[model samples]
Target: MERSINVLALMKDGERFIFLYDEQSTPQLLQTLGRYAADPEMSFSWYDAAVLSQKVRRLKESQERTTPDVRRSA
Candidate 1:
């Protein structure tokens, strides 16, 4: 069975954005999107949830603030 394409939201450097295309697309998909990636500055690449998760992790790690402690005040 072929995996379907699903648009997903991805965050980079605290910025949120949407990414198009399915993460499980075959090599043929790469060939199809090659034109979009031809530019040196702007290019589209396939990024799965795992990859995106890592990026989010890194962003969280790089932060210089302490995690907020949720507590009830008397």
Candidate 2:
């Protein structure tokens, strides 16, 4: 299966963060690392992929909650 970059950061708050991008574009981001790494004189390094998938499945039986049936009388 083709893989997409999905970096999730689970924060203290009940919120999920997802960073999706291409591996080839990482060199641009390395500039923020530091001057030593930012200098064009330095070479950039590449890393392998480490991926994880989140799965959701509902197994237990549950009643379907719906709005109460409405009736009108004239």
lDDT of all predictions: 0.46, 0.30
For each of the candidates, the C-alpha root-mean-square deviation to the true structure, in angstroms, is 13.1, 16.2
lDDT of 1: 0.46
Considering summed lDDT, which 10 consecutive residues are worst modelled in model 1?
A: 64-73
Put down candidate 2 lDDT per residue, 1-74, tens digits, no spaces.
34345233322245443334444444432333334334565342121011111210011111112323235321
TM-score for each model: 0.26, 0.24
lDDT of 1 by residue, 1-74 (tens): 34445444645566565645544443334344444345455434344344544544454454414434335321
**Candidate 1 TM-score to native:** 0.26
Worst lDDT window (10 residues) for model 2?
A: 55-64
Per lDDT, the best of the predicted structures is 1
Evaluate residue 37 in candidate 1 and report its C-alpha lDDT on the 0 to 100 scale: 43
Candidate 2 pairs with clashing backbones: none
